[model samples]
Each structure stands twice: as C-alpha cells, then as structure tokens.
Target: MNFKEQLTRFPILETVAKAAAELGVEAYIIGGFVRDLILSRASKDIDVVSVGNGIELAERVAARLGPDVFVSIYKNFGTAQIRQCDLEIEFVGARKESYRTDSRKPAVEDGTLSDDQNRRDFTINAMGISLNKDTFGELVDPFEGVRDLKRKIIRTPLEPEITFSDDPLRMMRAIRFASQLNFDIEPDTFDAIIKMKERIGIVSAERISDELNKIILSPTPSYGFKLLYHAGILAIMFPEMIELLGVETIDGKGHKDNFYHTLQVLDNVAQHTDDLWLRWAAILHDIAKPATKKFDKKVGWSFHNHEEVGARMVPVIFRRMKLPLNEKMRFVKKLVRLHLRPIVLSKEEITDSAMRRLLVEAGEDIEALMKLCRADITSKNPDKVKRFLHNFDLVEQKLKDLEERDKLRNFQPVITGEIIMETFGLKPAKEVGIIKEIVREAILEGIIPNEYEPAFAYMVHEGEKLGLSVQSTGTTFE
Candidate 1:
C-alpha cells in the first residue's frame, strides 16, 4: 500500500526528504513509526534512519525548520533529535550491532538500511518507509512485516535465538510487545526466550523494571508476567514475587495460590483504574500471605497479619526492583497495609466510629483505598461479589457521613501536647501523650464531640482520673 496519505499528515517528512536530497543521504522513516503507521496507531515519536551521517542530516533538517525549533544532538551515540510542535523526530545512521556474551551493549558501525532492519527486536518494527524523493513513502518490508502484523505475531527479523542472545532484553521486549498489542509470541520466539532466559541476568535491574512496568500497564498484564514466569526470567529477576506461587497443604488444609490470586487482583484493579501504584498495591496486597500462612483445625487456612507484613516488605521490594522509593512507594505501602481494613468493615456492620477511624488513617487516600477494596472482590460466585460491593457502598456512605460530621479525614486532636502540659501545669512528659491519646480516642469513639469545649472537658476528666489536677479548675471537670 502507498503510505502517501500518512506522510501528508506529517509535513516534516517533506523537509526530511529535502534535507536528505541536499545531503545526498538515503533516509527512511523506520522502526516503531513505520510499525505503528501500518497498524494505524497514533504515534508522536518518529524515527528516521539514513545511510550517511545522521547528525549532519538532522542539522540540515533543523536549519530548514529555522530557529524556533529545538534540536538536541547526542554525538557519542551518533543520534540527534528535533522537536517540532508536539512531535519528536529522532535521526540515526543505519547501523549493525555485535554483542559480547557478558554485556548487552552493542559494538556499533554504520551500515546499510537492511543491516539496521535486521537488528530490530521484532519483525513488525523492522519495516521502513523510504523518504528519498523518487521513492517517497514507499514501504520496504524486507521480512514481510505487514504479513506478520496481519497475523498478529511477535517474531524476530532474524533467528530468534541469535536475536535474543545478542541482547537478552529483547526477550522481555518480545513479551511486552505481545502483551501491549495482544499478539501471540511466535512459538519459535517463545522457545528462544526460554532458551536465552538466563541471559536476562546481564540486563540491569532498571532496564528490566522498565519493561516490567510496560507489562504492568498493558491491558492484560498477566499475559506478559505468565510468559516471564514460563521463560524463567521472573524467577531470576523477582524471586520474592515468584515465592507467591503454589499452594501448600497440611492435613487436608490448604491455602489458595497467592501468586494467581495476586494476578487476579491486579487484573481486577486494571479494569477499574489505570493508576500504576494502585495496581501495584493490588499486586502486593497479599504478598505476605506465604510468610504468614498457618493452618488450624477449625479454620482451614489463615494469613494472620499479612497486611502488616506486606507493608513492611514494600520498601525492600521497591528498593530491590529499582522502583521509586518516594511517595509512590509510600502510597503502595499504605494501601497494602490498609487493603484489608475496608474489607473487614464491609463484612461487619458499617459504623460511624469505624468509618471515622478509617477516614483519619486513610486521609486523602480514602478513595484509592475504596477502589482497591472494590477490586479485591474476586469471588467466583457473582452473588457474593455483589454482596461485598453492596456492603462496600454502605461503608463508603458511612465514611462520607463521618467525614462530613467530624471532619476526621487526617484529623488530629484539637488539644495539643503543649495545651495538655500547660493546662495541667506540667512539662513535656509521658502524661502529655496519655492525655492526647485520651482526647483523640474520645472524639473517635463518639464519647465527646470533636469541638474544643467538649474535648477540653473530657481531657480534664481523664487527667483527674490519673490523679492530675488542672490549674484552670475554675471551669470545672466534666
């Protein structure tokens, strides 16, 4: 098919063709831009490969575009980028790569366009559209990438084993692409990934995490993860998660496979929100079950304190996985710790006091917590799921009512430690904390209104019970 119409939408192609003509370089729009165009996928990033100096061609293109445009040159990599409007156009000389077994870094040298296409990670991405004046927009699908695109298959342009072994990260990329495109990994490609799976160890944790995040963000992440598991890359990369696999039985009591359950929860959360951290919370919500698993004669299986343990594990896991250790990590940790709270509330009678405590604890994260809790209902019985959802609605209503009345979302006691100390004619000591706790609990338990006068009266009464006298007894203790 003539891709002439597609080129018209991107007028920059004409400028590139003009630049290439002036420089006497054969240039083509290659790799992802071509693949996405063929698939009719909208892409903002355009990659152009030329037979001569890519940087020189980029300079010429930038000169033609004039001064307002921004062009960035990376001389070491022999690549240059130009930003026009919202589009990013990357220029690189066509090159071939050779890798040593110990590293993924390729020894690069300029070569023909076919050589560059041969090095692409997937057949679909190896296709290119020529930009030379005489052949402008003519597709050069040397490997019949369009046929593979129609087949919805992930295949390497070259032999799968050699393709993956040259750069093991391609194994992860293959699976990531399959997941993102909902394509099947060609059988030989799948087997090659398994064969070269051990080579993934040479890849940096950051690179692996990048691919993993892409998988996690895919419409169905489980597909990529399952491929990783079968290919044995996951075990080498994330053993802690792999540990969540399998069910162990003792005396006819067994626990559900936490691995599969985590995936189900991940998928369930995926269906609701696209927030990566929320989905991460789902993946980790039951992460500690294996560690906390126990069997009792009365109860078949129990995972006591899994939420707390999982919360504690989040920082270490994030650190190891090269994920952010900032607020995103803290958010995941908080959700993992509190994931069971809403479910417990749902199982019981929804109460204002309970909701007040939840609101105060969850604070601004209450809605995210609710989304997680609702996603956690993965029971096979449709009625059971419906019941949990209905109860969760009551719990949500209670939270809203409590928050509106008490203003307890992230609420702190109106009476401070300094107030307690000064009122009781004392220094900062254990008694101050005791008084603050009493006042806070009184408000939470509905023993007194959260207003200042009622809390002050209740605080004085609690202090008197502790054999402490307030200097301002002219007000009298309640």
Candidate 2:
C-alpha cells in the first residue's frame, strides 16, 4: 500500500530519505508512526529504521535539518534520537534479536528490514513505509499488518508465546494497545497472554506500573482491567486488586463484587476527568473492604473503617507498584480516607460544621474528592442512584454556599505555634501545640472566626485553662 499523500504531510521524512540515500542504506518510517498514520491518530513520535548504522543516519539527518538541530546517540543500543520542535524522531538499525531465558534484553545484530518487522510485538506496529526516492510511501508489511489494523485486532507478527516470552513487557503492551485503541486481541494472542501470565514477573515494577497507568488513562479503562483480570495477569501483577474479584455470601445476603464495582467507579471517574490520581482514588476507595469486612445478621455485611485502612495501604501499594511516593501518593491517600465523608453527609442532615471540616481537611482537593465520591455511586437500582445523585447535588450546593461564606478551601489556622509560644513565653512544648489545636478547632467549628484577634483571644483563654499564664498581651503575640 502506498500513502504518498500522507507521507508528504511530513516534510521531515524527505530529509530522512535524503540522509539515508547519502549513507547508501535502506531506511523506513516504521513502528508506531506508521500504525498511527494509518489509523488517523495524531502522533508526534516517529521511529526510523535503517539498514546500516542508525547513529550515522541520525547525524546526517541532523546536519541536513540545520546546525541548531541535535542528534542524541546511544552507541551501545545502536539508536539515536532527534528533537525537532514538537516532533521526536528516533533512528535505530534494523536488527534481529535473540533473548535469553531470564532477560528481555536481546542479543542484537544488524539485519534487513524484514528481520526488524518480524520481531515486532504486534502486527499493527510492524508495518513500515519505505523512505527511498523511488519507493517513498511503499509499505513493507510481510505480516499483513494493514489487514489487522482494518480488522481492529492485536496479534503478534511472530508466535504470540514467543513474542511475549522474549520480552514479557510486550504482554502488557499488547493489552495497553488494545485498551488505548479499543481493539480486540486475537483469541490465540489473548490465550497466549493467559498462558504466559507468570512470565510478567520478569518485567520490572516500573515498567508494569507505566503500562498500568496508561491503561488507567484510557477512555474506557475498565476494559483493559477486565482483560488483565480475565487473563490472570492481575493476579500476579496486582494481587490486591484481584482480591476484590469475588463476593462472599453468608445466609441469604451477599455483598457486591468490589472488583467490578471499582471498575465501574474508575469508568465513571474517567468520564469526568483525566486526572490519573483521581482515577487511582476510585480504584482504591474500597480497596480495604476485604480486610475490614464483618458479617452481622442484621446488617448482612459491613466494611467498617475500610476507608482509613485503604488510605494507609496507599503508600505501601504505591511503593510496591513503583509509583511515586510524593504529593501524588498523598493525594490518593487523602481521597481514599475522606471518600465516605461526603456520602455520609448526603445520607444524613448536612451540617455547616461537617462541611467546614470536610473543606478544611480536603483543602484544594475537595472538588476532586467530590468527583471520586460521585463516581463511587455504582448501584444497579436506578431510583437509588437518582436519589443519591440528588442528595449529592444538595451537598455540593451546601459546600459551595459555605465555601463562599467562609473561604476554607485553602483553610489554615491563623494562629501559629510561634505565636502560641510567644503568648505563653513557653518553648516548643505540648502546651503550645494544644493551644494551636484549640484555636484551629474553634475556627473550623465556627466558634471563632479564622482571624488574628479572635483566634489570639481564644488561644489566650485556652492557655489559662491549660495552666499556662499569658505572659504577653494580644499585641505582643500578634
């Protein structure tokens, strides 16, 4: 197949062709760039495969591009990359690979373009468009990649087992591509994933988590997760999530399958926002249910304090998954802990103090927390869903109203520990912390406005109760 018009759209390909011709080597725009071009997906990354040294080709292309352009070379891997404005083009030599039993890293040797395409993980990604002057847009697809693309299938060019076994990370990539493009894996290929599920243990946690995050960010992320679950990959990669799979029944009552519920919540959050951490919160909001589940004759089943337990589990899970344990981790943890607070408020009489406390605790993340909570409503009963949604609207309105009256979104205590220490002429002690907490609580409870004067006055009174004499007046403390 020729895509001359499409190839013409990227004038940089002409420079690549010129560079390859000067080096007297066959070069083609291959892999993801070719796949996305056929699918009409906008892509900024281009992979160029050369029959000779890829670094030389990159150098020539860079020189042709201009003096300002820089080509980054990795001689050990026989690859080079050039950044041109918004576009990133990578150059690599066509090579045949032989993988060891223990490692995914391949023994590389320069070969023909056919050898390169044969090693591709998926058919759609194996297609390449020649960059020669005579065959400018000719696709070299021995594996019928275009047909697979038309059929919307993910199939390895080589044997599925061999492909996945050679680089087990390709198993995750297969599922990721299927999820990202909403394509189906070929039956044989999917089965191969199931058969090779254990091999994924060889892949690093960072690589696994990277693919998992991509799956989470997909339009319908639950599809990818369901694939992982069905293939048994989730069992090995994320046992915590897999533990949410089945429902336990006692007597005539049973709880919902939390695994599917989590997927539903994740899908709902995906519709509202693309924040990966928010979606992560949805996945983990009920993660500790299994640990905290208790059976009672009257209540059937209850997961008491699962939210707090799940919040504590967040750091451990993130560390295990090789995800960053920074502010993002804290964000997920906070959401998990407070996820039930708004739902509880909606079921009960909404209070100003409750709203204030939620606002104060959630801070800038209150809106995100609300989105996650809204997504957590996954009941099958339409009436129940409708009633909960209505209550949520009411709760949101109250939050908005209260937030306007008292700007508590970024609420912090006006009285600092330093001020407390100054007021009592005390060093860093429990008395100072106690006074600060009292003032903070008073403001949050609306007993005193979050201001310097009233907070200072309350701190002074609290100091007296704690048997700490106020050595200085309000001015001195202020």
TM-score per model over all chains = 0.96, 0.98
The CA-based lDDT of model 2 is what?
0.93
Can you tell me which runs of candidate 2 are displaced by over 4 Å?
A: none
For each of the candidates, give the backbone clash count: 0, 0
Best by TM-score: 2
List per-prediction Cα lDDT, in the order shown: 0.90, 0.93
Model 1 spans with C-alpha error above 4 angstroms: 471-478
Model 1 gets an lDDT of 0.90
Clashing pairs in 2: none
Question: What is candidate 1's CA lDDT for residue 200?
Answer: 90
